[model samples]
Target chain A: MKLVVHMGVLLGVGLGLGLADMALRPLAESAENATDINDLIGQTDPDSGTPANTEPDVDTPEIRDPVDDGTGNTEPVDDGTSDNTEPVVDTPPDVPVVTSEPEFPRTTPGPNWPAHHVTVEQASQLFGRPDVLFVDARALDKFEEGHVQGAICLPLEAFHGQQPQILEFHTSMDFPIVVIYCGGGDCEESDAVRDLLMPDGYENVYVMHDGWPGWVKMGLPGETGQGEFEGFYDW
Target chain B: MGDKDSCSAGCGMTRWIALPVRVALGGVFVFAAFNKLFITNGPALFNKSIHAFKLDEYGMTEGMMTLSTHLVPWVELVAGLALILGFWLRAAATITGAMLVVFIAMYASVLLRDLNVECGCFGKLSPFCPKTVGSCHILQNATMLLMAGLLAWWGRSAISVDGMLAGKAKAPADAA
Candidate 1:
């Protein structure tokens, strides 16, 4: 009886303390303003106190500017803000916003183009189509290094925390056809993000089967270094 | 009576030595649990780390993982506090020791799989973190296990509530 009483007291204290901590935590990092991968397991550089970039050790010349359309649409520039907020992508007036799925030619069920899988060709076809939005499910550093041109960085690890912003961003795009991808073959992050998006009323979602490496291997137009991407907004 | 006095003196010295070990084991658990339970998105992060162990391959479901993520911290917290107070020292030490065993096994599994993910045992307080579950984490758990095992072997200490109770019970028996 004495043991039981002591155990009960300890249990009560633990539960009480746990609840108090969660409830009284600062609201500075709520769902809407939650950061990307850096907030989720990203290590801080002990010397700088800033998140250290965890990008793969593949060095390539940084693309100096965004792909200029010659329509006076200048490149998207990062504000270089200390908060690490992703630079907002300016939607040009000419960019088409599709509210529904579109009819595309070539519907072959190849190994790379299975149902729910978009081949590199298929992804390229959808690229800049205004109806398709590519979502990069890799870490922020990797996403910054190189991604499908115009791809939005919403890493799989931080998906739950950044779900609100993802949903809001898609809603702004009128819920375009979202093609999600990560590092490449065997990287299940894209599939995981797709699973998450489906429950939230996001239809027309497809996992890019080729992934980022697939795009790079195929020599498809790619952007390196913080192109037009939505970053974590630390408010 | 001389033998009893000498034995008592030895036991008293042992208790003093065991006190710090008990306190250390208890303090570690308390700190670990406090971070896991209280930090922002602590439970969710812990849940992710648990899943990274690939328990699903061993037939553990997402629901069970989620339950464990929440349950483990409270168990650690209660057991830790009990050990610190020296109330139910045996039970507390046994529980903590068992937990360490499980932790050691999980980290060993991580090593076998060559996974590169944080242990997340102390939430954000993993000061020695390679930020990955590796040999260091296993060694840490082993150290804790040793402490808990020693506490269990020593039973109660002289500076404890349990010891006071034992003394009161013995006094009544002597008077009778």
Candidate 2:
């Protein structure tokens, strides 16, 4: 009967699975063992300061998705100020939303919005141009922690309940080109700002993928805290 | 010697396969949904796995992903409940057969793409990713496919309402 044939097939499949699992079990065990032992593969060398007994950080560094849509990303974000001083980027507890890299084939790729995310060199040109206006999308506090020099810090949250405020900020609409960058290539803060600005008729908004980290990695100028950058930090 | 008409439609034969098929596939859904409801970070982990694949790069939207979160569980729950009670056996079998076909296709595509990603299916046994391209998930679905096909082929035989209804219909003939 057909039912009998089906059982027969399922049985064959089960046996094959069992055999495969048995053959692979030892290899699987060894692989896990190696991963457990080698997680700190580089850290334990005598000169390396990593504590040998300490477990490696559970948070794996985000790797580039192999199927990258060509936009560069996964930057170590910082307030524009981190020098050689702070090497490890700590996971900030308060901010739950990480910036998203601008996905291409963007549902609506319109201009007068944050340009499709660009690389370091592309961002540098925009930042260096006198006609360009950069908006830092991190919160005021985060901006204080680090921010690009000459960029205005206008936290995206400002548009939370108030649509009017975003318009007021963009009152100068046409002249200087507006670009927003949040936490570098890994974040999407810049994109949201662009979307908001687009509908508000701000005409031109851009998200810098090589955002905070992009600027930092290139050794560009930035300041920390409510210092000389004060006026621009809250824009 | 040949009552060809009864066998031609296959109504009698299909009923036989439905019982086991419903139970097995329904069990998978029941198991899947129960864990989804109970696990502390089930949705997050599953969503993370989805992102981990960069499916968005392939045009899967956030809305689509969110839709799956709710839709998958509901289908599993409803199908499972009906399957357990042997209620609506025909509808359950047909839908389940369709879903399994989709699963097989997805697995095939993953294999074709050589994507080494967790399938995020059975959530509990699904390995923490950076998983290898070669996966057993395709085989798992193939088995489910057979079950679905078998059930669809035999609508009522094992332990189903279809059989009960057929039996009731035949009772009058026996009485005569």
Candidate 3:
């Protein structure tokens, strides 16, 4: 009976203190206005000469006049001269304006997506910028095998153990634009890492929707090796 | 009365041995709880650590996670203090033993699933085991479980609060 009473008391005290702590803590920041993608969309980098937003140009079909050769045969022909061709529809079928953007289809977030979801093109634009910091949220093996050129590996599972390293890196910057990525399809590691960082006052975090596979597929710069702080072996 | 007599009889040597074990176990718990509760953004970071276990896939909701985030360190704190002060050694040992069992099970699960997760056992300070989950963590928790078991089996120790209280309660009965 005394053992039961002691157990009850300990549990009751723990629960009471827990409730009090929860009530005292401030509510987490909401997803409203969390994404800064809109602000980033139209901005152009002067040095790179690449426009941040590369929404594909809509193709206009060429309108050719039918020519009659007096044999009652009307044929639409290429005139080989610019006189009959519409100037606006002169883009060659073989060459596209935005060659940097890959043709492969990539997953995109829905309308109500909370995190700042960036496509591979946008991520490529942000890449190598002094203000941007890429974080890989995959396991250590995957990160060491291949990852974005300068991305630091902060696997979602190891975040707590690496908190000091993370804080030191974050504080070393003046609020850098952090982009976190994981394995492309259906991986939530990037979002999970972002969530962990956000509560610690990292506001500029974004998720690469298509992830590392997309980056690699687009022929973006990447490197293979262990990251600086990912010294703990997964095995 | 019976408990005090047993402590004074053949169990005298065992009580002395259990003292250091109880104190050491309590100290470890206290230190761990301190790291989890007092560090900067400790709770939030600990929450992320818990999420890494992917308990959501096991049907644990966000609400349950939040509750655990708040409850675990506090329990550790209270139980640890109780053990050190020897106010309720049996109860404290029972609580910590139960927790160690859970931790060993969690480590085993993580290993079996081949999930590459770091052990958030000591937050950012992993003194005993490697940060990543491995057999070392299971061994460490198992050792702690043994210490807790020893403390629980040998209820009260010499020079303890429980001993003092028991003596005081017995004094009036002797006068009667």
TM-score of chain B of each: 0.91, 0.73, 0.93
lDDT of 1: 0.63
lDDT of 3 by residue, A1-235 (tens): 7887997898778778878877776224332235455456456555543343444223223322122122322232221111111112233345423321122213233233455776666777778888788988888778888888988887877756666666566666664578898885457888888877764546678887667766765567888887555554443
- Candidate 1 C-alpha error for residue A144, in Å: 9.7
| DockQ-based CAPRI category assigned to the predicted complex of candidate 3 | acceptable
Residues A128-196 of candidate 2 have per-residue lDDT tens digits of: 566666778877877778777767667778776543555565665453466677765346667777655
TM-score of chain B of 3: 0.93
Please tell me which predicted candidate would have the highest lDDT against the true structure: 3
Candidate order, DockQ descending:
3, 1, 2
Of candidate 3 chain B, the 10-residue stretch with the lowest lDDT total is B1-10
| Best-first order by TM-score | 3, 1, 2
What would the per-residue lDDT of candidate 1 be over residues A1-235, giving only the tens digit for each residue?
6545655666667666545544554222221122221222235456633244422122322322112232332333221211112322232334343311111111121333335765454565556767667888888788877788888777776655555566676556754467898865456888887765553335567776647765664456789766754444221
DockQ of every candidate = 0.08, 0.03, 0.25
Give candidate 1 regions above 4 Å deviation.
Answer: A1-235, B1-10
Query: Per-residue lDDT for B14-124 in model 2, tens only?
Result: 555555668777888677666543353444444445554656766989877655554555465666655655655545655666666876676666777776565656553
- Docking class for candidate 2: incorrect
Measured by DockQ, the strongest candidate is 3
